[model samples]
Target: MQRRGLLLILSSPSGAGKSTLARRLMGWDPTIRFSVSATTRAPRPGEEDGREYYFRSRAQFEAMIADQQMLEHAEVFGNLYGSPRGPVEAAMAEGRDTLFDIDWQGGQQIRNSALGRDVVSVFVLPPSIAELDRRLRGRAQDSEEVIAGRMAKSRDEISHWAEYDYVLVNDDIDRSFKQLQTILEAERMRRDRQPALTDFVRGLNREFEQR
Candidate 1:
C-alpha cells in the first residue's frame, strides 16, 4: 500500500533550532512540503514575498478570518500571522507530507479541523535557559531590553512543550537533526499512515479464508 503523508508540525521557542531542523528535513526528503503562512507584517530588508511569507494586507487577512479561510490566525509581537487551509488540505489529500512551523495556538486550530489525526506534532526545546540567552546574545541583533523581552516570551513558549506529541532537545544541531529525521521516519511507518493498509489486510484475510 502506498503511504499517505502525515502532517509534521514543528514548533519551538526562540533559538531552539526548530527552523534549522525543519530546513534540513525538507532538503533531505522530497516528499515533505512546507506550509507557508500568510502574515500582515511587512517584509524584512531582504525578505521576498511568497517565498519567505505570503504577505497580505490587514483587510485581506481579516476577510479570510471572517470567511473561515484561515486554519489559524493570531497576533504575535504586534503582527498578524496565520496558516491558510486550502494548500495544506490539498497537499495532504495528494499524499504529500505538509510541514507546519506554527505556535501552540496555530496547532490547536489544525487539531480542531477535520485533518487532525493526519498531524504529528513535535516541539523543540533549548538545552537550558542560560544557553538560550547566550545564543540570543551571540546574534548581536537585539538590544538588551529587546533580549529581555524575547527571554520572557521564550519562557511562555517553552511552557507549552507538554502539549506536543514529541519533544526534542536541541543541544547539538547534527544530533538533534538526526533525532528529528528518526521521528519522521518512525511516524511514516505506522500502520495507519498507509491509507490502503486496511483493504490490503482484508484481502489477505479473504485469501486465508479461501485456503
Candidate 2:
C-alpha cells in the first residue's frame, strides 16, 4: 500500500542526545529527509550554505517569515531559525518523510500548523539534571557561562514535555534509538497514512460477497 508521508519532530533540551538520535535515524533510513533550517546566525567553521543550514541574513530570515514561507520559526540565543515550507511539503507530497530536529517552541508551532495532522512529535528528556549538566560539559565546545545558560534553559524546555505525543528518556543511546525505531514503524502503519488501504478493503469486501 502506498502511504502518505509524515513529519517526525524530535525536540529536546541541548545535550539530551536528540541531535545524535536524529543523525542515527537518518542513517537507519536514508530515505528520510532532514529538514534543513534557515538560520540568521553566522555559519560555523566547515558549515556550508544549504547543507548545515540555509545561512540567511537576519533581514532575509525575517522576509521569509513575513512571506509565510517558513513551516515554523523561532528566535533562539539572539538568532532566528526556521524550516522552509516548500521543500518539506514537496517531499511529503512525494511520499517521503521529513525529520525535524527543533526545540519545543518550533515543535509546538509545527504541531499546530495546517500540517499538524501528519505530525508525530517526540520530546527527549535527560535521565537527570546532573547528567544533563555533565553531558553539556563533556561536549567541550562551550564555555562555562554558555553551559550554565543551557542548563538553566533546559528546565524550561523540560516543562513542555507533556506537549509531545511521545516522550523518551535518553539514558542509553541504543535503547532509545530502538524505541524511536519502534515508534516510527508503528506510526507508518496508521490507517490514515495508508490511503491505498481503502481500495484494498473494498476489494476484500467484494470478494467476500462473491464467495
Candidate 3:
C-alpha cells in the first residue's frame, strides 16, 4: 500500500505573513510543491516562463476555461489567473503534497472539487487590525492610496476566517510556524492518507500469531 498526497491551502489578509510561513514550511519540507498558477499578464523583469507563472494570452486562457483545463480561476484587477489541473494531478499521484497560497475563493474552489477530501485548509490572521496596518506600512513599497485599498480589502478577507479547518493568529512568526509544522505532521499521519498502514498492521498480526 501507498500514501496519497494532500493539498495544503493557506489563506490570509494582505499583511498577515502567510507568504512568510509558506516559505518557511517549504524550507522545512522540500518535498512539498508550490502550486504555480497561469496568468494572462505579461512576465515582469527576471520572471521566467513556467517558473513564476505560465503566461498566456487572454484568448488562450479563455480556451483553457472552455476546455475545463483550469482547476480554479478568477479575475483579479481585470486580469485572469488560474491553477492548471494537469501538474497538480500529476503531483498528487506521485505522493507529493501541493501548497496553495491563495485567497478564500480559490481555496473554496479547490476544497469543493473532485479531490476535496484531500484538502487541509488553514487561515492566518493578524494579531490585531492595528498590527496589520503597521505591517502593511512597514513594507514601504505601497503608497497611502494602495495601503488604504489593501486595508479595506483586508476586512473582507478576514471575514472568511471561519471557512478554514485551522485558524492561526500570527502574533509571532516562530510560534505560528511551529503550529503550522505540527498541523502538517498530524495531517500526514491520518489513517486515510497512509494506505500502507493496512498492510503493516496485517504483517504485525501475522508475526504475533506465529510467535
Ranking according to TM-score, highest score first: 2, 3, 1
Q: After superposition, how far is residue 63 of candidate 3 from its true place, in Å?
A: 2.4
**TM-scores vs. true structure, each candidate:** 0.92, 0.93, 0.93
Error of 1 at 149 (Å): 0.4
Clashes in predicted model 3: 0
Tens digits of per-residue lDDT, candidate 3, 45-112, equal 99988989999999999999998888889999999999888888888888889999999889889889
| Model 1: residues with Cα > 4 Å off, grouped in runs | none
Question: How many clashes show up in model 2?
Answer: 0
Runs of candidate 3 with Cα error greater than 4 angstroms are 201-211
lDDT per residue as tens, model 1, 1-211: 5777788989898788888998999999877889889999999999888888999999999999998888888998788999888887788778889999988888878877777888899999999999999988997887889999999888988888998899988999999999988998899889888879899889999999999
Please tell me which model should have the higher TM-score, number 1 or number 2.
Answer: 2
Give, for candidate 2, the lowest lDDT window spanning 10 residues: 143-152
Candidate lDDT scores, in order, read 0.88, 0.93, 0.93
- For candidate 3, what's the RMSD? 1.9
